[model samples]
Target: MSDTGSYNAVTWLLDRNVDEGRASKLAFTDTVSELTYGDLQKQSRRVANMLRRLGVRREERVAMIMLDTTDFPAVFLGAIRAGIVPVPLNTLLTSDQYAYVLADCRARVLFISEALLPVVKDMVGRLSDLDHVVVCGNDAHGFKKLSDELAGESDSFVTVPTHADEPAFWLYSSGSTGMPKGVRHLHSNLAATAETYASQVLGIREDDVCLSAAKLFFAYGLGNALTFPMSVGATTVLNSERPTPATMFALMNKYNPSIFFGVPTLFSAMLHDEALKHERGGTRLRICTSAGEALPESVGNAWKARFGVDILDGVGSTELLHIFLSNSPDDIKYGTSGRPVPGYKVRLVNEAGAEVSDGEVGELLVDAPSAGEGYWNQRSKSRRTFEGHWTRTGDKYVRDAEGRYTFCGRSDDMFKVSGIWVSPFEVESALITHPAVLEAAVVPEADPEGLLKPKAFVVLRADAKTQGLQEALKEHVQQKIGVWKYPRWIEVVDALPKTATGKIQRFKLRDGAR
Candidate 1:
């Protein structure tokens, strides 16, 4: 796994699995079909041959709007095997976002699932760079069917000799604050994450089974269900439908997955789900991880008490690929994000570009081995985010004397009230500790005097009464954290706006406040 020299990620992730006598092992099981390690390699090779037959030259981009099925891994790895870059788009985005990304990356081919064809079917002809539209499932709708195309191709195409530093894939930012940016990742970056976080932190083994509630399009999910499992020839479970508590519990009971990956929102929802209360501890889940947002201490502790397993609440971004700072199973910290993984380094710095001391909040910067190369077209942004080896995470955090980091808020989400900075995450965490609150988002709102104060938007539990709940929640936060951090106003909402990855869109809330 050297940084230099010729290396194709597919060689290590797919080919080696078969070469080591794991060809017959179940590599992936989707809702519809199962893929063995033998079948995955063969199908990926066929995909490489089909793309070449369709005149998709080396290094050209291919956009994937498919779900969390077996087809996703075959296409994703196949493109990289053939030296083509695959851009996995979020399936939940609007048609305009798909068109923008297609045009932005100038994707030559689009491999969309049959279920998602209607989302961008009308705009297919409008994309000038798009040469082919291959549907993954049935009903091609006058377009090319992927199964038919692969049928005529050979399953033994030689993998293209690609450099470790060459671009292999692209993941768009979840765009919590603004438009999604194309984050280009190199071939070496994939193994770097597997070796650092997956191997060291997760301690993934070949016999383990994995299930990730996060979709394959997300960075966290991509690592959880695809790379980490594939790195050790482990099996993974994939579900196409939305991840509700019922659906997640059903999968756990059926598959008995050894590792489960989820976000904070899903964990909170599952905790409140009464119907599935008897299904707890039914799975073989030895390790659970959370990302996409900070896991509240209350939610983490309750989950552990019920499931008899600790949730390793970590933080990761699309820019760095996967989690660099995470809590390990041995060292469990309920409130703070755990120390950095063995291979990664983290630092918190102030506005003056100086490192902050313990207990002082500052923006976090990470020097990760898996850091992306740069944004696809935005040069200024790439320069700002990736400075030499250090990448700015744009997350505000405070380090304790013992070296654990606690999430404060995003850099733009933090605001000063009465000349003191107030963290939206801190207030939101406090609000969630209340028994009546299911989820909460805190944003700064201007008062009558033109001063900013914490304003909360909360989603109450199903059985909780709304009468006198706002004041109760305010007092609860005031007592838990401090009086100065209490929300000035509270709005009971059915749901908060979130990105595809389950991160609350706080900026959208701030926009409405104005």
Candidate 2:
């Protein structure tokens, strides 16, 4: 591999304002705990020293099971500085799910936070390769305290020289079908993703205050919160708990940030909050972004109308470790995801790997430096996902004449209904366009006549679940997309099952439809 003329992930972040000797520049929550660039450098070096002392070697996997807090970046960058790969585990995973990932990644050093200690203890026996369990808390059983180890260590450590192809982090694929697979990403790939997603697409500035609704474990959230902000000299606001609409609103009011990164579900809920709408337009919010799933056109319009700001939607995957295509703030379209980011090549291809005609639906393939090296420990699946330097994102999309990409749905979510192929995302998008529907998921349901008909699971916008509204919504779909695509059955559900990253779990809708 040739040199990309770039520093690895750790050096790239540390070089920003390291000469100034300031770490916490601004006050956080009216407290002095805010981290500055200089503080980041010192903590990262100390974490690197701690990892090296704990016998962590280059390319060895260290699993982190913690919430989004100040320690996350220190530990993550420290591992990178020490030339070790950090595998962040999803906090929401059950004992079995956590055990499987730990066993599969073969992580020798497992770090746990106090909040997640109970589940970590349940899987401790199942993880045979795990030699250490460092807890970010007070005295804990069967674990070393993380706070005591990094107290007085000198902030002077040398970064190990690592090849560009050396593993930097291991992200797991979102397992919609079965168990998730480990994805190995090189340091070069992470750096490339930071440049493309933060520089080209987000155009994030150093003075920007960034806060993300997605968690730290998800790839989208990881890039948006940590990597993207660090690429520039931006401050990231991390909330360790789950982000409810109330929590997000209070944070925005308190922090007064410029950028808010979230999924469509979060955006839609924010639009409905009267308190948020009343105070948002008076604020200085520069841009809002939606990703990890398609943003409904109605949600985009609703947010824009309320805040006088457009919500730029994008598409990305864990396999790629960052966003592939996104709508920039200056050139955003309400409904469509904009063209691919600079330095990335995107194409819609058919089953034979040939380019599809314009306006034709096919799998979205991306040729970017950000794509993962391959799936860890699964060579066959790796071959299928990574082809000839391009990563095949398993999403079906259409390219318009202007080169804008319109997401149809996941390739697996597109199924035949009455001999016509239907995209669940498209149907759900249409259903939400109706005024009464707050959220919706479309799936194939078998009719009494043994035919698969489109079914919609909907959550009413308000307490307006009157009989008049349901019939009007069914008619609205018929008028908008035509009779063939209309959902034959509509179920008013209170809530939809969602992934930890805020993606709607269509598999649950499919099962409920059946």
Candidate 3:
């Protein structure tokens, strides 16, 4: 290897932080521990040394099932430094789900947090390609102890020379409908995302500290909790638990972060949560961002009215890494997914593969430098999605005359009722506006003749889940939205099923388990 040949994504981020005089700056924090840029850089190098000592080769995948804790980024950055492709698995998933991904990726080493190791360790027996398991918490439980081993390793390691186009990391899709697909990203995508979205759109500053309701594993959370903040040498708050409204507010109070990233469901919960209503004094949040699911207009408006903060919602996918079409601070529309960011090009394409005009709904396509290489082991699906210079987002949207895009629903999720098209997101947004409604999901249910009609699976307020609430909710939708688009059937459940990132599983509702 040449003395100075390549730009490693990991070392570049660390060097940028050091060069900007942020060596002693707070880089990551949690309930139990905090780490600075100097600490992170040193620990990440030690992790790389540990991996090399374990005989892990360049470009080999190191899969992790970890929380949004201090160890997540250190190990992730270490993989990037060593030119190892890091595969961050969703922390909350069934053993079968973990088995599917671990088997698919054939990851050489598996690093699991301590709390989860007991349940997941048995699966290692079935994984023929897995060579070792390294636990991330205090005690390793007979497996390799990650923190203990790093303590003995040297804190100096040379960054592997990887080309710009080579694979750097892989984020598995949320798999709300089916098995997860790995979205592979190149080495250059991370830096480009920081330059375009974080710099131009969000205007992130070095003084800004970020807290994300989305975990570190999801694409949105990874950018918010790690890449975006670290790009400007900013600090990030890490929470290890699931992103309940209670947990989020606690982090906000503890960290007083300037930026809070969340999904629509959490925003909805916080708006109606009794505990948070009385305590909204000093979060110091300048602006809030929402993604992973479309932020319902009702939820967005309620959040602003309740908390005095505007939530800028946007559209992004695992393939694009982060938000490409987003609502900026100065140009936020409560109901629209704002215009494209500086370095991204957007297209609304119809079924004929032609661009749709303003006021017409079509599938959304985004072309960005931060786009992923392709899905792993799925050639045909990759060909359909990862076209040259563009990625099909699979969500349908309508563009306004001013170039603002309103999210309709997933292209596959859109249904027809009596020869007219119906967007579940539109109806779901309307359903959520009802006073008694807390959360909602709309899907198509078929009859004997195979004709489909809109059906709603709802989670009502504690007192409103009583008898006859279904008919009232149906009428509420009829009044709020189009009469024909109202749900023909309604079922009230205790909670809506969601992915680890809080995206509603509408497909589960379609299967009639509710």
Poorest 10 consecutive residues of model 3 by lDDT? 1-10
Model 1: which ten-residue window has the lowest total lDDT? 276-285
Candidate 2 deviates by what RMSD?
2.2
Higher-TM-score candidate of 1 and 3: 1
lDDT of 1 by residue, 351-397 (tens): 99999999999999999999999998999999999999899999999
- Ranking of predictions according to lDDT: 1, 3, 2
lDDT of each residue in 356-470, candidate 3, tens digit only:
8999889998889899989999999999998898899999999999999998898888988888879999898888888788888889988668788888887878656466777
By TM-score rank, best first, the candidates go 1, 3, 2
Between prediction 1 and prediction 2, the one with superior TM-score is: 1
Query: What value does the lDDT take at residue 505 in candidate 3?
Result: 76
Instruction: Indicate which candidate wins on TM-score.
Output: 1
